[model samples]
Target: MIPLDEARARILAGLAPTGPETVPLAAGWNRVLARPIAARLTQPPADVSAMDGYALRAADAVEGATLRLAGASPAGKPYAGTLGAGEAVRIFTGGFVPAGADSILLQEDATAAEGHVRVNETVMLGRHIRRRGLDFAEGAELLGAGRRLTARDIGLAAAGNHPWLTVHRRPRIGILATGDEIALPGEKLPEGGIVSSNAHALAALVASCGGEASILPIAPDDPAEIAALASSGGFDLLVTTGGASVGEHDLVQKALGRDGFVLDFWQIAMRPGKPLIWGKLGAVPVLGLPGNPVSALVCAVVFLLPALAKLQGLADTATPTLRALAGVDLPANDKRADHLRATLTPGEGGVWIATPAARQDSSMLAVLAGADALVLRAPFAPKLAKGEPVEVIALAALGV
Candidate 1:
């Protein structure tokens, strides 16, 4: 058993970044950029009007000056006439500022009669003009590599004149389960059978972490059948939740070894999840999690999430750590670090008060649903007093 930090570092170090592929801009959202995207054209490209008014030479707008009205210039259409002293062009918002025009006096600010207009207020040069390339210069870097594309990123890409982009391809995960004790959900359970919820939960977990997940049929704890199924290829990662412990029917470890696979870490110093296994089968990374539903999910959040991020060249994910005051006094364990399920409620002083659920058992689903965070209690921690501060991991961060 090792410290949790040491275990995380080891797992991260063994992973590699994913490769890049070109994808249509529409489908690129939530994907990481493979390279910098530079602007292909200048925004606005030319001086344009910022409002519907008259475009005139600012110097000609002397206190009592009146200007002859030129042709109208609406958006997407520009007047051929140029502004001169005592002359103004009728311009609408987004219309090109006619050549020689310096500013615009809104119609509300001037009096119009016949073919001329009167300047009712003083105007400044360069007012109401959107200069060429003011928003973004041509060839400017608009998006950088490793940046996650959001809807906003797509809009930025379109603004940068990019119709498509290169991004990291999502990893494909294969999920398998080994245990005759489990049966598929929605089917009648046999005398000693239980519903197989872990595989579906794992599949959902993989997708939330940005990977494509496929749940294969369960492999009963038969050594020959397990070895054959586990050795089959076609996935970047393999995940199995059962038969990972030291029990006699725990064939996952032996099945991988029988096919010449190298094991990494088999167990860690964590409660309800000490018998986790990780290794490589051929070129695929394999994670054998414990059968306990909550335990499997916790391990997935702790390990699999980081693996997917690593494969996509994403930065190390920061867990949502919150400071909370304990609402109850509790005894402490000395070896395995505990992740106690707790219900959080808003408290005074801008803090959250965490009340550990009464049923801390790993297999209790009803109590887990009511929990919004897992209060992390360190191994060997002394008995905690009520109102003491403790670090909590937000359940939402795990994509629960």
Candidate 2:
């Protein structure tokens, strides 16, 4: 058995970043950038007015100065001629500043007749004017690579005059659930049959991390059948729920071994999920998760999701852990690292207290759903009193 960090490193070491593709600006949201995006054109190509007011020479905009309204400049239309001494132009918001106009005497600070205007207040030079390239200059790097474009990023890219962008393709994942006794949800259950939900849960987790997930049909206990189905999925990554352990009915290893695959690691020393398997079959990476619902989701959050992020060119894949106070006196852990389901609430002095669930059965989905975080207990950790500091991983990151 290997440690959690070793398992994570092994998984990442065997994977490669996905290829890049060109997409339209409308489809670039939430996609990772393949290369740095540079501005195609300077913002505010020319000097423009920011407010609806009179545009005139700053030297002639002093108090009590009267000027003739030579012409008008509305948005998208510019005055054909330049300004002269004691001359002003009726410029609206976003209108291009007429040539030779040094500043704008605000409408609120001036009194205007039919063709003449009188300045009531002193005006400063270059006031209320948005200069050329005020926001971004041409050829400037607007956004760097490896950034996941958000709605705001899309708008910013559009402002840079980009109609399309280059981004990494979303990873495609194929999920398989193996067992004859398991049936999908909303189906009639046979005697002693159970509902199959691990595939659905795994799909949701994969999709939330920006991967394309497809749940395949269930496979029985036959090794040949499992191998055939697993080998033909054609996905970037293959994930199986059961038959990963060495039990009699464990056929996932038999079908995925020998001919065209290289096994990276098989198991790890951890609670809830220990019978995990990872390797490469041809060019596709295979991740074998446990059948237990909570264990499957836990392992997905810790391992599988990180792999997806790495493939997507994400900078960091570390799971977030927070410090909290224990609500009860917990005993020492064994050789296997433990992840206990618990609820976190505010305690005295603004510290959060975590209370572990009484029953941590891997099959209990209700308890897992109610849990806010998984308090991490290192292997062979000593006993702890109530109010002791403990590390916790939030379950909300799993999108449960």
Candidate 3:
């Protein structure tokens, strides 16, 4: 079996980002940018007031001084006439500073009477004024390519005068769950059969990572059935759960071979997910995962999430992890890397304590669902006692 990192690298190397499409700014949230967004016009346009105050010449405004009230400058409407000496303009927040005004006397610090205003405090030059282009300059890059648009990013793009944005098309994923003993939820099951959960779980994962997922009909143990469904192209990537291992019913590789499927590598040095498969069928990349629920989801987190990120034109494709302390004594690991489902608790000094579930059997979907994190145990890692530091992937943070 190959190492997990090598398998992930090979899968990513075989895939490219989806093509770009234009969408309205309102629809840009969570979409990866295909091009940089530049500022269309200078922000503020000109020197403006940052507070509700009176715009006046700093030299003429002094403590206990009175000035003639010229005109009011509201947000959208500007005072056309310039301010003369001993004259002040009534300006509100976001109002352009009238010509010949160098400072602002806050309304709270001034008293207004008939046709005049009294300054109780001395006004400083250039105070309470926001200069032109304070937020951004025209043609300045506000956001770069490969960035996923957040609510803040959407606001920034709108403020930059962009009504539409160019983003990579959402990667379309075809999910296939194949097994003779598994039936759909709420269906009459054969004796000792189980309900299929991998397809729905994987589809949710794909959507969470910005990919569109279509769950294909389940295929039984027959190679012909598997091949027929897999070759129905139009997917950026085809994900198959089950039939990846070397068992008699594991016919994914064999079935695809009839349709010119090119095998890249199969199996990885990882616990609960050693029977992973990475290959290609014609133009669509194929990733075959173990049928076990825990194995399917864990491998999806390890490999499929990064693959989706790459396909969406994201700049960073690596899985994010956090540091935590072991809550129990861990035994020595062997050749396979381990991903122990664990619960996270707050420890002293702001450190997190990760305690693995007692039953790590891959069939226990409940244990995997209740887990807060997956503590990573590298191959050949030495035994670690309680309180030892380790790296972990926080499942909730990844929206798994």
All candidates: TM-score: 0.90, 0.90, 0.99
lDDT of 3: 0.96
lDDT of 2 by residue, 1-400 (tens): 9998899999988777688999999999888888989999998888999999999999999999899999999998899899999999999988999999989989999999989999999899999999999999999999998888989999999999999999888988999999878989998876788999999988988887788989988888887788788887568899899887889888787777744767888889999899999988888899999888888888887889788888887777677789999989999999888999999999989878999999999999899889999999999999999999999997785565
Error of 2 at 131 (Å): 2.5
Candidate 3, residues 1-400: lDDT per residue as tens digits?
A: 9998898999899999999999999999999999999999999799999999899999988999999999999999999999999999999999999999999999999999999999999999999999999999999999999999999999999999999999999999999999898888888887888999999999999998899999998999999999999988899999999999998999999999999999999989999999998888999999999999999999999999999999999999999999999999999999999999999999999999999999999999999999999999999999999999999999998889
Q: Flag clash pairs in model 2.
A: none
* Candidate 2 TM-score, true structure as reference: 0.90
Measured over all alpha carbons after superposition, the RMSD of each candidate to the real structure, in angstroms, is 2.5, 2.7, 0.9
Say which candidate scores most in TM-score. 3
Prediction 1 TM-score vs. true? 0.90
The candidate, 1 or 2, that scores higher on TM-score is: 1
- Please report, in order, the local distance difference test score of every candidate based on alpha carbons: 0.83, 0.89, 0.96
Off by more than 4 A, model 2? 321-332, 344-356, 380-391, 397-400
Name every residue pair that clashes in candidate 1.
18-311
Residue range 243-300, candidate 1, lDDT tens digits: 9889999889887788877898888898768888888887888888899887887777
